[model samples]
Target: MVAKRRQFITDSILLASSAVAFPHVAGAAQSKRIKIGQIGTAHAHASGKMSAIRSLPEIFEVVGIVEPDKERRKKAESAAAYQGLTFLEQDQLLNTPGLAAVAVETEIEQLTPTAIQCLKAGMHVHVDKPAGTTMTECHALHDEATRQGKTVQMGYMLRYNPAFELLFQVIRDGWLGNLTELSGTMGKYANDATRKQLAAFPGGGMFELACHLIDAMVTVLGKPDQVTPYAFRSHPEKDTFADNQLATFHYPNLVATIRCNHIDPFGGPRRAFEVAGEAGLFQIQPLEPGKVRLGLTQPHGPFKKGFQNVPVRKTTGRYDDEFRDLAKIARGEKELAWDSKHDLAVHEAVLLASGMPIN
Candidate 1:
């Protein structure tokens, strides 16, 4: 149990390494740019996802967009990312000729159902996170995608970050021998409106934000043998809002901790993940477009002993690499890096950690 828990690279080492070696060119066949569309501009990341797709013009062509809600559509229409792009009704966009894939960026609850619709319409999908607040929709969506022979890429962007890419290799190679403890913090100050929005979900802070780190945790540690959750409130006068949350994941010889809060003014810069092994310590704070710190007992590869900095290449934006890879998978040039089974494992862990009902 202990050995399996720390085996971060259970998926093919090539699957793990391809992230570091991103922009991996497929066999001699040259594939054309995939024609893609966006659905539902209400999600926080909807515009950003659209922008990322447009940025990779070499990999994808923006066919059109779908935003069902009139108010949300009106707001998104004027956003810089959506300007000049045609906005069509849901059916029109899904039925567009040559529509190879869709970015399902609906409001949190609609994410899975929207993606499932695209899959049924013969489009691959990039659905955003938490897979919704429960397991039922997530299961149905994955089942439909599998039945349709289409890819459903969850919107967890950290998997492609260069720092995480290298860290996976370090731990997998036994550079961090015998992982003993791991902890991560994800938090941001949220006002009344935000808290009320996130509170609708069972885990509130942890479900809304910490799920990102939870995805990272399960990626490195696998699902915890058991997870003990602590949910409490820091909201001034609200009782239902779990504004502060923590989960302790139990393993045979390892312990992992995930903490999230809606009350950190410095939370943006404080977001961090740290791993402690007998041989070394690896930490990344403010974890996106990641900056890393490494402490080693002895030199490993080109990295020196003691605390040394690992150079992370400049990231144009977090979504660029994922969308580029999405294009390849949509074009049949490559297989999905992390498959449906892995995605379900991550969501199961997320629900467990968030104190949400699994069903």
Candidate 2:
């Protein structure tokens, strides 16, 4: 039995390694490709998301890109990601015939506004994370999309992560019992330029990065009653950026802490999410190329009572399954996994956790 388990683990690791090397081929068969347009390239993940859309030739057809800022357009044009794409004015892109959706990849402050315009234009929208700097705007966008029956997909990448997907299932199955505590951290070393950019926002690294983990936590724990945040500058020499921050979400029975910092020596590997419950504990470290560790009070399914490493399929890339899910939702083949109400709640909690004013 021990030998069989070892062999199975080895085989799973080898398969995941191959998947990392080669992108996952999505089996989306649509009569016509979803005509997708992109708005803005200011967001850091814009190019990467666009590249993912382009890679899935069978699912999406990039109609055009809208960049009102001339300098931003000029700068993006030289990049390989935007080399072959056509640039159009906002109205032109919104009015494009057969445009099914738009990826609102704009600056953090512009995300909600751009998404609102796209929603008003009768198109599904894939707005990037940290929906916006304000909850009111985020709620308006989500509410409008809900009324229009349009899909408003927030680009919270972990929703599609294989390990996270499994963790969700495990929790739903009651394998983890009643959740008592959850903790996560997403931090990295930043250069001076990055520090300067982050310092512009009061939330600093927490707003820029911790929002991702907060989204995941809300998915797992639901909305918390109170959010207490602690913002600190671990390295004042660097800049005024709130380089280190921690936010605690308080629930009746659970307390969750999410920490983000700018000075972890090996931040990538240290990024993690841990859930502790009466029945067991589940943790995933280095969220990308995710590795899951599980502990249980009693034997369950194929897992032993003690801690054991579990194998999850590696992602092709960050946005591989994200785009795939978007295609399915656009094609009316699948309902959005994360609906607007959930998104609004998550965004509200995120703002509070980031030490931003709700009103």
Candidate 3:
């Protein structure tokens, strides 16, 4: 049975890679400039995403920003990225004439609520990672967006990453035969201030960082039968945050583990994901400027059996493709790549993995 499965996967890899290699390109003529707004700047990636949206003048026009926290607004105003951006109250941004979409970039606690408000206001939203702390609120927002036929694009950046896109294609093509084990590690050195910021969440580093890998794992493996989380505060610092954590996801056919830490000496180059299967293995390190290494049982297509470095298209930047996709969905040029069902499942898995209460 295993041999047959391996053969099947090897055969399918070619077909899968072909389909993913040539995705439907969004056309310039069909592109419409989407009038967008941003809500909150407390999330770490909020300013970066806003700046990215502002750069894409042809596809998006960021009309205004809604930041409720005076302190947070003041901090953001000092950043060059947020400079010159209109600051409006939440209601004003939501009620702006011809508003087409909103980017929900609030602190983790406020993500779902703000997204729900945007959906209620008849605007599509790009809610950031983990989809907030609660499953109920995330579901409520997703359901409302579904009922209104609006898009809720989760800010899981890797979904738009070219390297991950190639990895997904390889898996779908059966090039990796019967995925047995998948592992990912994401970590960084957190300073006193960053550690304090992360200490606010129970899951700490895992909640803030590993959620990215969890999103990718769930995308490839779907919902797991069980998620076992091991959270720890390995640092000597006097903080209650769980600075080191690992979550093992058990599925019928696959067992995956994700490890995250806030104090890795070599975290930058060590950030990586690996997939091991009956027929092959694939690894990507330094997930940002993604570099992939592929291994097969035998030579298949352009890849050799032992190992080979796979090259992918250069990433324009983190948020460029994501905002472009959002604009396309807002303009009715294409349906959302991820639907409410997928987002809901991903959020559920993330909460479970992060050791957060789902109810």
Scored by TM-score, the top model is: 1
Instruction: List candidate 3 stretches off by more than 4 Å.
Output: 1-25
As for candidate 3, its clashing pairs are: 13-173
lDDT of each: 0.82, 0.83, 0.81
What lDDT does model 3 reach? Answer: 0.81
**Where does model 2 exceed 4 Å of error?**
1-29
Q: Which residue pairs of candidate 2 clash?
A: none
lDDT of 3 by residue, 1-359 (tens): 43343334334333333333444534433545789999989888998898889888777888989888889889888888888989999999999999999999998888988899899999999998878778888879888998888998889898777778778778867787878899999998888899888888887888788888987887777777899888988765678878888999998877899999888888879999999999999899989899999999978778888989989887557887788777767877556655676677777877787888888
lDDT of 1 by residue, 126-149 (tens): 998879877888899899998999
For each of the candidates, give the backbone clash count.
0, 0, 1
Cα shift from native, residue 247, model 3 (Å) = 0.8
Superposition TM-score, candidate 3 onto the true structure: 0.91
Best of the two (2, 3) by TM-score: 3
The residue pairs found clashing in candidate 1 are: none
Mark the regions of model 1 whose C-alpha exceeds 4 Å error after superposition: 1-29, 236-239
**Ranking, lDDT, top scorer first:** 2, 1, 3
